[model samples]
Every structure is written in C-alpha cells, then in structure tokens.
Target: MYVPVSLLFFFIGTALFVYYKTQPGLLPETVTGDQVFPYFIVNGLPAGFTGLLIAAIFAAGMSTVSTSINSSATVVLTDFFNVTSHSEADEKRKMNILHATSVILGALGVGVGLAMMSVKSALDAWWSMAAIFSGGMLGLFFLGYIARGIKGSYAFVGVICGVLLIAWMSLSRQTVFHNYLTIVLGTLVIFTVGMLLAIAGSRLKKGN
Candidate 1:
C-alpha cells in the first residue's frame, strides 16, 4: 500500500513541479520546496476549495495527533503503571490514569509544536528527532530478534553502545553520517555486539 501510494504521490508531485516550472512567473526563485504546495494551494486554487482543503488538512493532522497521544498514553500505562486485567476498581483507576496521561501528553505535544514554529522545515526537524529517538528503540528490537543466549548484561551493553553512537552521530556536527542512517547503524551495532558477546560467552564457558 505504501509503495504504490508513494509512487503515485511521486508522479503527482513531479507533475506539479513540471507545471509550475513550465509556466512563466508562476513560481518565484525565493520560494522553497516546503512552501511550494502551500503557495500553490493558496494562490492557484479557488478560495472556497482552498478552505475545504485546508480543513481536510487539519482533520488529517488531528487524526494523527490523536493517535500519537493515545499510543503514548498506553505506553505510559503499560510501562509505568503496569496496568493489567484486575478488579473493576483497578480497571477504573487505570482508565483514569490513562485519561490523565492523554491530557498531559496532548498539552506537551501542543507545546512542542509551538516551539517548532521557528524551524525552517518542520519535516526536517521531525526526521531528526525521530531518528534520534528511534535509534535506541530499533537497536533494542534488533538485539532481541537476532541474538540467542545473550545475557542481559551483554544486551544492555550493546544497547548502551548503540545509543551512544546514535547520540554522537546526531549531536556531533563533524560526523559524516546522515540523520536517517542513525537508526540503521544503531540497530546493526546492537545486534552485532550482542551476538558476538553471546558467542564469546559460550566459547569461554566451554573452555572453562
């Protein structure tokens, strides 16, 4: 689904760019790639249709925002509260906590969104942050999936090393790695280190 959708979107975007470029005085040199679509929607489309499109955009944004807030709240409930199937009173308490978490997370999301207004490109900022956070997560997943008989200490060490590499790659301006490669490299590092440690441990045990 994503592949076809991405292909179609690419073609459509290509057509839009061609249309804008071929037309004289339609697009200004100062306009950026991020602003191109919004510029077209506001300047090219009819006012009523533009309003409808903007409303739809808001609707889509709200949908994703709600999903993120809900998911984050659920994670907090599971990880922090350790909520499980229990008595009715406990269930109710869990529900209340979830609600409170959702509200707090929603406020934080709004604050972060407002803070990001000064960024030149929202997408770039989002990708950078996503890469930084997702690296550790992906590394842990890879370590669990690929490693067998790896001790908890080995897994922890691998995850810590992967996280440090990701931080270095993201925070150090002199690093050559791209923002998107952080997750990939981090995952590989975790898996490789964990597997090697597990193998070494097994060999040492046999030798002893």
Candidate 2:
C-alpha cells in the first residue's frame, strides 16, 4: 500500500502537472521548483530524473489532449448527430455543435490551469482536486452501472460531502505526504453516499 501510494505521487502527480503546463496560458514561469530541484540531489546524473519528469509531463499533456478531443468527437457524432441511433440535425448543425464543444473544452481546460495557481503545493493541490472532482464520476459508475437501481440523488449528496470535506481540509492547511487524507475522505464519501442512494432508489422503485 505504502509503496504504491508513493509511486502514485512520484508518477501520477508528476504527469498531471506536465499536462497542466502543456495547456495554453499555463506554461512554466521563472526558475521554480522544477528548475531548482536536480534529478539527484546528492550527485548529478546525465539523462536523469529531470529528463524522466519532462517525458512524463509531455506524455500526460498529450494524452489529455488526445482523449478530450476523442471524447468530444464521439459526443458530437453520437449525441448531437444521433449517428447510429438517428440523425436529427443536418450536417451543418452537427458540425457547429462539435466545434462549439471543442472550443468550450479548451477554454475550460485553460480556466482550470489558471485556477491552480492559488494552490499551496503542486502535488497536494493536484491530488486533492483530483479526489474531489473524480469522486462523483466514480459514484455515478458505482450507483448507475455497478449497483442496481441506485438513486442519482444519493450520488449527488456523496459528491457534495466529498467537496465540503476537501474544501475544509484545503482551508485548514492540513498537509500530509501522498495526499492520503484526500483519497480516504473522497472514497469514504463516495462509498457511503452510493450505498445510501442504492438503498433509497431500491425502496423507491419497489414502492412505485
């Protein structure tokens, strides 16, 4: 558990940051942490850890851009076009919607990167934010797909709790390595709320 968690920080954490930098308006500023920290503190290394970090960052940024573009394309084709299901709109309308969505997603990504400037530590901020944002998606999967007849309301509530707790932690200045608190808090909220919603949704379904 400990090793895996540590790896997540060293790997996933670094990757997320690199992704952020790749976005427009979020490029690196002066000689900050990334520039200051040597690959190996004790001894210099060639083609070393800094190289690895740079590679990881590019991979992350490229991956995000690729996936977001793909998802947007799929959504336009399937949802707006109703391609396989049905094509309600004409080609022009569908094309317009796809373009609009692409612009929106790009704008939103820039906004998120800008917002991240206020975060105290890069790793801590990323982990905590990821936990808070992803909990609801995870809850939706558990409630809608994995569990039978789970209520959407319960999932919403769980997400709310997760946000509140994370926000409180953010304000309180509680710092722990590996961001264990955020993960534990987020998972607990998601699991509890999902279970409750599943129970309630089941009861409601049975009653009606």
Candidate 3:
C-alpha cells in the first residue's frame, strides 16, 4: 500500500513537473527548477485553492521545524547538560534551559534556511547531504542485520571505508556513482567488508 501510494504520488508529481518545465512561456528562463512549482501554484491556481495550498505548506513546514528544534533541544540538554540527573525541584530550571536551547536552535535553523536560499536546487542539495551523511549509519544498519559474527572494530573499519567512498562520490567530480546511490553502495560496502573480515577471522581461529 505504502509503496504503491508513494509511486503514484511521485509519478503524478513528476509528470506534472515535466509538463510545466517543458511548456514554454509558462515559466521564465530565470525561474529555477525549485522556484517553478511554487511560482505555478501561486500564479496558476485559483485564489482560494492557492491560499489553502500555501497554508498547508506552511503548516507542514512549521511542524517539521518545531519537531527538529525540540529534538535538538532535548539532545543538547540530556547529552551535554545531563539535565535528567537533576532534582525534582530543578524541573523548572530544566524547563527554562530547554526553552532557551529551543529558541537558540530555532534561530540557527532559520539562519541556515536563509543561507540555503542561494543554492540552485534545494532538493538536490538535500539529497547530496543525505547521501553523504547516511553512509555511516546505513552501513551500521546493514552490518547489524546482515553481517553475522562481525565485531564492532571490523564494522568500524567497514563504516570508515563506506564513508570514504560516499564522500568521494559526493565531493569528487571524477566519481562515476550518482548521489542517490551513495547510501546504497556505502551500506553494501560496509556489510560486505565486515562479513569478509569476520569469515577470515573465524577461519584463522579454526586453523590456529
């Protein structure tokens, strides 16, 4: 259900996007790929519908931003400040700290968003960054699920290799792999390397 729904959603979206992009005079040459959809929504749609869509977009954005800020604040307080170890009376102090952290993080998030406005394509930039950063975690996930008898040290080595591969793929113009494939390749690399090392280790142990 989920897969089919997602496929349908993307299929329809891509088709409409392509139509809009290829249709001449609908969008100016100066309008970027990222700006095209919003521009269309505002200009093409009826007034009431346009307002509703804009409101929906704002609601989604606000929800996501709030969640991120809250999560970040929780991490900062729990991990760095050790707020959880505080006394019951200090709950007020913790609340104050959390509020302050959330405000600071939210401000930082706004700054980053403003900075990213200059980027050509927000979607492309996001995917590239996601691919680069997801490598280590995705590799670890694969190792945990697929690579039997693999020790943490060997897994760490595999993750390092995977991260390097992903980084090179993302940063180097010479790399053949696409940005979308980075996490896939990185996870496979980590799992494969870790499994091979584990097998070799076991073989050596048996021989010894």
Residues 132-177, model 3: lDDT tens digits: 7776897788788876557888898888888888888887889787
Off by over 4 Å in 3: 1-9, 18-23, 79-89, 196-208
Q: What is the lDDT of residue 203 in candidate 1?
A: 93
TM-score of 2: 0.53
Q: Is candidate 1 or candidate 2 better by TM-score?
A: 1
Model 3 / residue 189 / CA error / Å:
3.1
- What clash pairs does model 2 have? none
**Alpha-carbon RMSD, candidate 2:** 9.1
lDDT of 2 by residue, 1-208 (tens): 8689789757854764575556524434553554323322212335576577678878988897969876977687776558564537778877777777778888887898898777656666766666665645654565566665555677778778767765565545555523556656665677777787678777888999
Q: Please report how far candidate 1 places residue 34 from its true position, in Å.
A: 1.3
Cα lDDT, model 1, residue 55: 99
Per-residue accuracy of model 1 over 1-208 as CA lDDT, tens digit each:
8689779857867887998879948988888767888888899899999999999999989998999989999898887677464534477888998999999998898899899878787656766776666677776776677665568998888888887888788768898887768888888888888888888989999999
